[model samples]
Target: MVDALLDIAGLRAGYESTTVLRDIDLRVEEGQLSVVIGPNGHGKTTLLRAISGLVTSSAGRITFAGQDITRMRPEAISARGLVHIPQGDALFPDMTVLENLTLGAFLRRGGRAERSQQLAVVYDIFPRLAERSSQRARTLSGGERRMLALGRGLMADARMLMIDEPSLGLAPVLVDEVYRQIARIAESGMTILLVEENFSRVRDLADRLTLIENGEVRASGTVQEVLADPAVAATYLGIES
Candidate 1:
């Protein structure tokens, strides 16, 4: 049986006095790529925030690595190897690429050599980052900045990476390139839970697809299963059965 690395049951959260997510149920299995696709403003980002402890859940339970972490502090959650890379490239504008990357390892416990080795691994996955290691993060192009954000997440030595809208605010070409690197990371055995607005981009990469609408799970299964559902096809895919 495949073990669920992250599980959410009936999770509800939102800004103060307003609920955005209601009865959200989802699970990401170990060593698999799970994709959550939905329209904008449908609580996709909010769900990720609740999982990462940036937004607290008002009800339900969140279990990570077999422990209940419904109310864990954000830093405490990060220490458990669950890393969240938000939608935009949240890098340090004045910091160099290398500086931003190293900061992701703050939760990691090790000496210089160990950190260096991990840095090498990330560099191998994203050569462009290595090439621009000395350049200020703000100077890099959109795609390069996304790569840096991902590289920083990997630097955390994350057991599972939660990325929100990686393709957001990028040119078509850059979106493809970013997804290619994401596939490379998944190929290297990184468990990823990715949020995307476009289903076509992730249809081939996702092991499982969960559809969220109005802050609740609308459909979830293997990619084929969800795509084949008549209601989902008609409403989300614009296909009539």
Candidate 2:
């Protein structure tokens, strides 16, 4: 088998006095859609933050595409094509949707032609964003905002995209639309690490599934392998069969 595109081993990170992730090891192959699912406050968000350089790691190593990025600054990491989209739709609400997406290419080394090409790619995946290009981000609907956030990430030309809580706080109908866009992104050849609280929306989308709890990995395997375990099914999934 080939090496994983993103390899994290013994990753431990947290805030001042609170250690959230402990000895976590995860690997994602190129072109795979991997997901980490768990209950709230179990360090799921922190895991993505650490990988994205938002939080510092006290121990362990993170290597992406054979480069050691454990201590690289967030911007430096992003320039190398690893991008993170955190929870809560972190957008410049006052800026026009086009402005926010242009910011995503801040670290990219390219001229207007290249940038426009990337913008076209994002717009193709999310035509709604193209339609609202001149509108302020704050004026978009809940689902549209999420799509804009995703479009901005694409502007970075990311090789690996780590997204936190893509389904949070959306109506069922909107959730379906957002997830469909994510699926389309994956199909376009970007490796994805999707972090979601519940599996109902993303259960069928992951190539590998990992369950995290109390700052540790409780289970990690193919979707069927992990979901078929009785304890995981009963405790988290509430599935009897």
Candidate 3:
């Protein structure tokens, strides 16, 4: 995959002998908004953890930008432009929004000038963050917290963002806003591997769709290609085809 931003082959990851992801293989080409959707506890989060180096793979190959990162530390992997925003508010709740956003750029080798530039981009994307820069992360609403999380990732200057459940808990209006912002992020040229349960919200935004079940890739292709399968409907969506 000469142009792939991220690639995984024969990936196996687990926790203390309990394997969560088994023999998994996936790829996200440069500038594509690819999604992985499945039922709960089906290794969706584990897959993202593995790629982000939070969970180590027992046997596999993970390549990012043509570099082998199978055994790289989470920080090292992140430094190389792969940022993972885990599922939920993985932020310092007591910290101000500005503080959380600034911490995201800590791993970068660049100095304050570069960090400032990244912050500018994040604030541009989510002006709400700029407005509430001094407020604690815990004080924000659900949708505002999500926006802050995403803004923090942008502050890290991510080339590929592996985000888990951007719309986990929110009202219908907030979900729409979050999805709209996500679509804008993709439009702004970031390769995204999103794990979202709200398939309806992302169906139109994703360039490719992958269905993961029981630790394996059960289906993958263009959104239409994956969704049109009878197996996907019957197995994941509970719809008889």
TM-score of each: 0.97, 0.98, 0.95
lDDT of 2 by residue, 1-241 (tens): 7899999999999999889999999999999999999999999999999998999999999999999999999988888999999987999999999999999888777799999999999999999999999999999999999999898998996899999998899998999999999999999889999999878877789999989999999999898998779999889866777
lDDT, candidate 2, at 61: 96
Considering only N, C-alpha and C atoms within 3 Å, which residue pairs clash in candidate 1?
none
RMSD of each: 1.1, 0.9, 1.4
Residue-wise lDDT of candidate 3 within 99-127, one digit each (tens)?
99999888876789999988888888898
* Model 3, position 42: C-alpha lDDT score: 91
**What is the model-wide C-alpha lDDT for candidate 1?**
0.94
Off by over 4 Å in 1: 239-241
Looking at model 3, report the run of 10 residues with the lowest lDDT sum: 232-241
Best first by lDDT, ranked? 1, 2, 3
Which is the winner by lDDT between candidate 1 and candidate 3? Answer: 1
Residue 75 of model 1, lDDT score: 92
Total backbone collisions, model 3: 0
Q: What's the lDDT for all of these models?
A: 0.94, 0.92, 0.90
TM-score of 3: 0.95
